[model samples]
Target: MKDSFDDPPPVPPSERASLPDGLRFAFGTLTVLPARITRWDRPAARTGMACAPVAGLAVGLLAAVPGVLLLLLGGGPLLAAAVTVAVPAALTRGLHLDGLADTADGLGSAKPADAALRIMKQSDIGPFGVIALLIVLLVQTAALADVYADSWVRGALATVAAAVAGRLAMTLASREGVPAARPEGLGAAVAGVVPSRAAVAVTALVTAAAALAALPLGLPTALQYAASVLAALAAAEMLLRRCVRRFGGVTGDVFGALCEVAGTTALVLLALG
Candidate 1:
């Protein structure tokens, strides 16, 4: 709620020689916008995954601004909520949503893990994917609208919480115990990249910050929302386990689904928590 939204200046060529590599990679890869990337390396990948939440914070702040302005302009909460949902989708090129759809298609195939992975890999959307995306988007939109109608402050907080929740889900999806479902692609690149201790630290910090930001909802309610964030995190973790069991391990698509699932789950809870 009280942090800089400013993007850091590009690293000078001189500084690039000494600066850490993965920081820029996170922004460049996670968000649609351009960020200077140095050579790709395992350390860079690890750093990128570890600092994933910073990307969440940046985009989350951006996503909330339009909604906050709409509220102040008396444009009504529904419009603001719709904009809030649309902003991230636009910024990320809807990759997370695509992932959610693909994951759903794979799981809904009701085939074995190998067969399901094949379904997920196909470019075309399946009925399961379509339905899953619709439900997730509808629920997120409705919940965000309700919060915006109640309090713009809480609505803004919800936006930020959702962003961080997604990134936090990334950590869960790429945790130590998880393995890449394939030998190539994003899942292979980032799986197990984030350190265990760092994941816990980031998750705890984000959940606490979410709690503090929701304080306007009253102390008891704030605590409930905080607990809900944890529940969302737990849910995301369990989802990753299910993916592992169902698909043989985590995949790039799985990471995207985790982000959407975790973010939506947290936002929905914040609506009523």
Candidate 2:
């Protein structure tokens, strides 16, 4: 599918400077919020991708509110988990889930890059896409359920960590040297826009923050949180490399897929801990 900002008209300098360009780009494109995107160039994308995790943090907090509320009000862990999982999907308008499905279809097709890309662009969901979505949602819900059963605080922390880790994957994916799969669309605009050093710095900061957030739970929990974030990023890197090799580079769909992969990985790791 074409990105909403694929060919956005230029915004006047005054309008562009009215809001922080990076944040506007981040929330505008990444969520169903009302943040207006004032710029669509590489500069905005660089800042947007760097701020992606901030957006994720917001989304995670929003999602956790209802689930935590439900658990506090006598709701079962399973139902609360389902709501927590559903909120993020609704907030993003299921863009990442759609991307995950499309990516699955493309990878499962086993066709040439061109043909697979064509398959991914189609509006219909193939068997691979259906199966991928089903499994991912199930795993995410189940992991959250287990965590929520332990305690609402841990569950909320897990949800936020997963959300942030997902966007952190996007930041790393956009680091210098990563290529876009096509010359047009979201991937082209943001791919390789962030410097490698900056991406690393963001990763470290996020990992530290995750550990610190869980510190009140215990030292072991704090270490587990940090490890989960790292593991999530590692999983995303593996998938990013595979997608680059298979499709030649990243796409909006690949970005979505990466978010889902990283989020799911983080939740699973947290549940295990």
Candidate 3:
């Protein structure tokens, strides 16, 4: 099977994008945000993946608002946590969750790569997909509820950190050397577009920022937040490796699975902390 997408025609240096263009691409592709993407070439994908955390941050903040308001209005922590979890799904139109379900079905099929990929592309969810979605959503909601019970501020910070961590996984997944499982669609467009060094730099920046965001809580909390980010990435990495071995590389479904895995791991760690 082919391991990568067929390259598009080379873009001229003069036609390359700036940072803003990349931001547009990130927001445009990653969320329901109104940002218009002006480019779709590899350079744009590189910038977009590098800026993915920024898009995640925006999504997190927006999602956090309602939960915070509900808490301020005396809503219970579980209710608040549910809303926080629901908002991101609404914003992304459940794209990631659907991806998670599809990926689960694919992996669970246990057939060869091509057969597994076909299973993933099917529209209907299978038993594995349903079970995976149920478990992940339950874990995310339960963990977040516990965090919210501790304090709303801590809960909000965890939500944001998880969101950022999820996108950070995408950045890492896009790093050069990762292959696309297919030769078309989102996986091909983004896979291997980001330089490894750039992905590392983005990861460091995001980890530092997450720790700094929790500093107001205390040094221990800050360190815990940093650890959560690392743990989240590690979880995502394990899944990515498995998908690569099982399916030959990544697809849109794999990316979605990575995001959810990372986000859930971050939330679980934050609750434990």
lDDT per residue as tens, model 2, 109-204: 999999999899899999999999999999999999999999999999999999999999999999877889989888898898876767878999
Question: Which digits, one per residue and each the tens of the lDDT, describe model 1 over residues 1-273?
Answer: 111233333444543322346668777778886788885655677768777777888888999999999999989999999999999999899988999999999888999988899999899999999999999999989999998888888888888888888887886666565688888888898886655666777778877887787777789867866777787788788888888888888888998899888889888888884
TM-score for every candidate vs. truth? 0.89, 0.93, 0.95
Candidate 1 lands at a TM-score of: 0.89
The local distance difference test score of each candidate is 0.81, 0.93, 0.92
**Candidate 2: stretches off by over 4 Å:** 1-19
lDDT: the better of candidates 1 and 3: 3
List residue ranges in candidate 1 displaced over 4 A. 1-20
Which digits, one per residue and each the tens of the lDDT, describe model 3 over residues 1-273?
A: 323344334557876678999999999888998999999988899889889999999989988999989999999999999999999998888889999999999999989999999999999999999999999999999999999999999989999999999999999999877899999989999998877767888999999999999999999999999999999999999999999999998999999899999999999999997
Candidate 2, residue 124: lDDT: 98
Task: Give per-candidate clash totals.
Answer: 0, 0, 0
Off by over 4 Å in 3: 1-12
- Would you list the rank order by TM-score, best first? 3, 2, 1
